[model samples]
Target: MDFKDYYVGLGVSPDADEKTIKKAYQKLAKKYHPDVNPGDKVAEEKFKEATEAYQAISDPEKRRKYDELRQDYQHWQKRGGRGDYNWDRWQTNPGRGGSGSQGHTMSPEDFAEMFGGAGRTGGFGGFGGEGYSDFFSTLFGGGGGQGRGFSGGSTVGRGRAGQDTEVDVQVSLEETFNGTTRLIRTGEKQIEAKIPKGVRTGSKVRLTGQGGPGIAGGPGGNLYLNITVSPHVHFVREGDDLRAKQPLDFYQAIFGGEVSVRTFDGEVLLKIPPRSQSGKKFRLKGKGMPNIERPDQRGDLFIELSIILPDDLSEQELSTLQELANKRG
Candidate 1:
């Protein structure tokens, strides 16, 4: 798959804000949804493309990664560096239309280091240390130490790599809480994805080199899985914490006792203190979702108390209540 220009795909500018991105996505999604364009393969493909593009750029982390990759690719082209330069042959082979001894081969890394490390920090080319830079130059040829003649004389054939693909996967709150695996159908293939414990909504899972097929046997692109967690019936997610209301009877609120509470794992017993207030909350440490990237860390769970009252009371109960009130008076 050729890499889709996300901004272009969404018909927005590179500097578009979150609101603009969302608006574009919603408008495009509604118009191009598969259901709306039934049996129209072209429309369906467009819809899928738009959806994938939106999914990639809408996320902060994924956007950052995409930006880096794009910058690297652009720089690669701008440098006029052919992907398939043979440094060994270049070093041994003389420059065309010049003295045979004048030609020298430089590795890609060396070429980058010599050309100011490819103009960006920590990227394929700019500013790597002397040792690394020299190593690459020796391997690929065309580094800063060599003149521009090396690239001009060589006629190396470079293969274009495949473009990346993005997909959005929505998971239920229960699946997120307990960690589950699902099979996703894309185009004609089914991919099995494992939802790791502690992944939050909007987290992305990267399947390296699984996107579009490579051109001329080069490495294929990557597949990005954007996750969306569905809302739970009883639980609300706050960061890693899970929050829910636990209803209690008036008597239970006034006189403490053991009450059953629901958790992501299962039902658990929670003790209510005597004279506990209706708005009181309890925290269950390490009960919330796991951190998506950090498996060892877990979030906390909070339970808010709600007091319920009976609609009617027996005559004996009413008499007992009256007597208690009289004694208090």
Candidate 2:
């Protein structure tokens, strides 16, 4: 079997840290994800390759075992002057007389079973069981082997951690102002999610021990809730700041007066400057959204004034306006 270089596949060095490996995997997976490239066999294959590589190297124990196997293969290659060697017999623990665990020498039938007849639900990388290569299975057990920490019913090594899950939660602008509680339905279980004040779009809240059940009594996974803030009809958000449009009568805009302004807190009197025109903006400090990190602090609210002119004046009023215009002229 050909030697599989997992580090090279992930475009990372052998000593790369776990965070680097995860970032590289996420990048590659996003680019070649089967969901992103439907019906593209090449892309699908690449995704599987990256997933397989990540699975092999992400775990410290698995990576250590794989590194040992890889070193031995490289030594053999150096000694043999470049030629194919029998990889089927290269199990970590070989049985006496080539007869131990059937895993030592996976048969064609076993390989087919591992792939699950090319179905997409239960296989390597959970990509519908396309099956890992014979070389991979030979060194680190099959897809269901101790490698990748998925052993089905067969117990091999220590306990396996649970899988993380993500879900989307939408909140209104008002809900974000004062914080709110939401009920999340996962399968038959219902969970109440507490959203703190100042959470905006793309905010992530992680709930520990709420993911997939662990294997072999390991700790459960975590649940990540992604916040999606809905659009507001009256106001728009820019970071912690808020922007809104307020209407003003022609008399108030021209002569300057106190105007009632509506904010998240309550109605406040805003001083309108004399000769204020349409599109004039006013700042109200500490009247906008709260800061996520420091809830005590807040941002300023900007209100753009829109001047509206009165219409359908009575004859007497029109005459008075004309007399005033005459005097001004």
Candidate 3:
């Protein structure tokens, strides 16, 4: 088989962080997964390439050796030699094997050396080798030369990470305006979590080491909290700005007057300009949701004017309006 540059295929730098490598792997895996693109040879090849890359980089020890080999190759090229230097000598020499770096092929002793001494045990339950055993063990959980460990009536159990749980909490707009903390119940455990001020729908707060119990003494996973903002009777949110509809009389719309308006925190008297029309909006700066990271900064609030007309009109009131219209004409 040809040497594959798995790192380049995954679009990650050699020194990329684990998080970056995982993110890149996830993206490429989703795009080129064989199950997602069945019968597509190109996608199959890409998927194989990405999986190998992820396996190499995700293992810290393997990644380090790969980096050393890469540096050595670069140095060899600089010394006026072809980049394709023979690694057979390096493979045979002890201590120079560089972690027994095999190029996709191995002999019986190589298998025993790479895996434990279990490979020579009657060809791993007559299944041929450790390579086949490890592959099937990872996939079907069987064939480790020990019939007791197989998935079907096997003694060795399959290890896996626990499932993650999600919860939603509702907070008032006012609470969101200044940020608040609350206690939540998950299963029998009660956790105290601080809800950031600007938290919106689908915003997730992660609590590490608080998920399901780990198997075989491994570390627990994590808990993700999705936030839901409760709608206020008078206030609404529009992006980073808060919105409200204030009811006003005809006089307030025609001739400006000071009116009391409700905000997330408290009531504030807003000055309405003369000749204000319906749907006129007033802005209050730094009055919306507080910044989750920075408590000092905040968004804005917008108030829209809504005119209310009297449903009942007496005869005198109608006649007065008619007289005023006649005088104006």
Candidate 4:
């Protein structure tokens, strides 16, 4: 197999950090994901190539080996020599037969981060054949007979499970209180997603078999919806509870009356006691956001009364207020 430049394939520098490499791969995966480009051979190949590059470098151990080999390849080329000698040397080296259990191997962390727990769900992870390249297998250990991947699975370079993906989804505050449905566009598919009630920011809605297409027809990965609840026009969220301001007229505060209060359910009449002060807080039991884990439970809504005085009070109204103050004194 020809030596592949994994860094060039993913458009990342050799010295890029794990976070940067992951970010670069995410963009490529989204663009060339097989699900997004069904039946397109070119796209499929590109997707596979990107996946290959990510696996090679996203892992520190694997990346270190690749980097070292890449330098050797570059240096060899500079000496007016092709990569044939490098390949021939490692392929014939008997000491290269370690099965990649130690140096230049894929780690559990690498598999989990890049392949969505590939270490736990081990499968083949190599180029067209030979599990990996001449350099990787030779340096890392594909040279062993009946070799097993570090993941404790069959030899690498076979079928691989698809990479998982995530999409940011925003919902209205009311939606969180009373569940909602959204038309989510993923890849080439438009999913009519029924968002459960009580999903807050950081909530994840997983869609099975919706991520990157499986390699060697293994299995499609999962897609996740990262929830972000939009701010409400009149309310702010606090845990499962909600808070809002309810405006009350000065007269209403002085002479107990019902005030219109907006809740997720609808507008309700909130009873105001006589002599209610501005900024007074009232709890409307079980009227807040729903508890995601506990379907049977809901939070309370707190309303702070804000007294609104007429901008231009009539003489009669001013005189009545003065008389009320005098009586109170």
Best by lDDT: 2
Instruction: List model 4 lDDT by residue over 213-251, tens digit each.
Output: 766654566678899999878999999888998888878
Q: What TM-score would candidate 2 get against the native?
A: 0.53
User: On residues 1-329, what C-alpha lDDT tens digit does candidate 1 reach at each position?
Assistant: 13346788899987888889978976776676544576777775566556556655777765676665556556545646444422221121122122222223234454345333442221112112111123222222323234333332433433333576888888898887778887866567677877777667777766666677666555556677899999888999999888999999889888899999988778899999999998899999988887665657789999999998766888998899899999999
Model 4 residue 142 distance off true place after TM-score fit, in angstroms: 14
TM-score, predicted candidate 4 vs. hidden true structure? 0.52
Candidate 3 — which residues are off by over 4 angstroms?
A: 1-163, 311-317
lDDT of each structure?
0.62, 0.71, 0.61, 0.70
Arranged by lDDT, best first = 2, 4, 1, 3
Indicate the residue-level lDDT of 38 in model 1.
64
Q: 3 or 4: which has the higher lDDT?
A: 4
lDDT per residue for candidate 3 within 1-329, as digits (tens), equals 13345578789887789988978976886677545676887885565456556666677866776676567656656645534564321121111111212222223464355333433321112212222223222222233334322112323333333445677778777777777887877777888987777777767766665667555544455677888887778777776777888899887888899999876667899999999988999888887767654557777988889999877878998899899999999
- Compute the lDDT of residue 17 as modeled in candidate 2: 98
After superposition on all C-alphas, the RMSD of every candidate to the true structure, in Å, is 19.0, 17.2, 16.7, 18.8
Q: How far in Å is the alpha carbon of 273 misplaced in model 4?
A: 1.7
lDDT of candidate model 2 versus the reference: 0.71
TM-score of each: 0.56, 0.53, 0.51, 0.52
Model 1, position 125, has a per-residue lDDT of: 23
Query: Candidate 4: minimum summed lDDT over ten consecutive residues — where?
Result: 119-128
By TM-score, the best candidate is: 1
Q: Give lDDT for model 1.
A: 0.62
